[model samples]
Target: MMTIMRNTKLSTRTAAKEASHERIVCVAARAIRRSGYDGTGVADIMKEAGLTHGAFYAHFASREAMLAEAAGRACAEAAAAAADGVASVPPEQALTYMFHAYLSRENLEQVERGCPLAALASETARQTPEVRRVSTRYIKEMVDLVARQSPDWGQPGSHERALVSVATMVGTLLLARIADEPALSDSLRAAALQHLPVA
Candidate 1:
């Protein structure tokens, strides 16, 4: 009989390294959302992650590489957040929950914790090829996530509807964030929510 053996030392080291790497990525995720891709600095991300600047080399190749990974990570998190309360429900119900949640005042106020797509899409066109590629992949993934929540998913126009829906949601939130007056922000978000298919 063969028994599985645990390499405790190797496991411990691997776990620690992965924890540090994830800490860096999490910090980068929030930073990119709050500061835009161009505005975020590798040194600052490292500092915010509670590590020295020199320690970055162990986890990533370069700043662009880190940004690419961070963009992907941030987008993934935003998608998960958007899907949070609606995940196990029927498509119609999920769409209703998502439509309002994505356009909520709370989501608008929470920049660091909000959707990276809303925060970063405008700036993605100016990012490096690697970063653009990362953003593109996640954009498609997010669209797909929303598409799956539509009752017409797998139908011909489902993708287009999802794309439009996501565009409206992101655009509404973007305008809401930059609008100087609270009423304008509320109007933007409320209008978008009103136009939702379930609305």
Candidate 2:
């Protein structure tokens, strides 16, 4: 019985550590999107997660590792949200729904909760290989997701169109957020939405 109690205690401790690790990752993910890679600090993330800064190393080997995990988490959340956005729509309407939702004002304002690609594209370009790798993987996944929404998904030009579409979406969002004037920001999104081949 003593041995069983020790094992049970160990299991409980491990579970709690795993939970805390997940909490840190989740908080860092949002912070990166909201503040960019250079802006998000380990201390800020740990404090926001309700964990002590000293405990951060216990969860991650280094800040870069945490950033890589956070990037992955952010990208996964964006992809899942995109998938959920169109899940109930008719097949032909999926791409249109995605285009409009991505350019919506809500997405424009919610940097932390919105697409990481739009929020961190420029910053990710300068991050370490691990973070860039995670971003690149998700970008490819996003392109495929868009391509699948095309009626001619497997046909020629479909993949190319998806690439262009994704670029346009990301670029537009980036510019929209950068524009100081609210009118320009709104117009940028409107123009992109107007030109998007929302089938």
Candidate 3:
């Protein structure tokens, strides 16, 4: 019975620690999205997480380390959300869903909670080498995921197609956000979607 109690206690502790780490990642992701990578500071993330600066070292080696993990997590969450939204549709329909959803006004207004790559790409270029490397890997992973959803492409030159799709979507979102005009944002989404080939 004593052994069982000790094991249960250990398990609870481990679970709590993991939950804390996840919280830190989530906080960092939001901060990075809102303020860009360079604009967000470690102290700020820690404060937002309700954690101390010293506790940050327990979760990450440095801010660059945290950024690397946060980038991957942010990308994975966005991709997973996109995948879930189109899971039941055919590949062609899935692509359409992704394109429309990405360029939609709802997505544009929630930049901090939307695609991290689109939110942080410009700032990521100025980050540490590790952050840049991780960001590159995450972008490639996202591109590959989208490419796999292209029914007409059949893998050949799919990467290029994915690049074009991502570039167009991100550009549209960025431009719409910068313009800050509701009608222009709607027009941008419509125009961008109109150009995508229907499979």
Cα RMSD for predicted model 3: 2.2
In the order shown, the candidates' Cα RMSDs to the true structure are: 3.4, 0.8, 2.2
lDDT: which candidate is best? 2
Question: What digit string (tens of lDDT, one per residue) describes model 1 on residues 151-183?
Answer: 788999889988988889888889899899999
Give residue 76's error in model 3 in angstroms.
0.9
- lDDT of model 2 at position 170: 96
- lDDT on C-alpha atoms for all candidate structures: 0.84, 0.93, 0.81
Over all chains combined, what TM-score does candidate 3 have?
0.87
lDDT of 3 by residue, 159-182 (tens): 788888878888887778778678
Winning candidate number (TM-score): 2
Q: Encode model 2's per-residue lDDT on 1-199: one tens digit a residue.
A: 9999999999999999999999999999999999999999998998999989999888889999999999999999999999998787998999999999999999999999999999998889899999999989998988999999999899999999999999999999999999999999999999998887765
Sort the predicted structures by TM-score, highest score first.
2, 1, 3
- Report how far off residue 67 is in candidate 2 (Å): 0.2
Each prediction's TM-score against the native?
0.88, 0.98, 0.87
> Residue 9, candidate 1: how far off, in angstroms?
5.1
Q: Which stretches of candidate 1 lie over 4 Å from their true place?
A: 1-11, 88-90
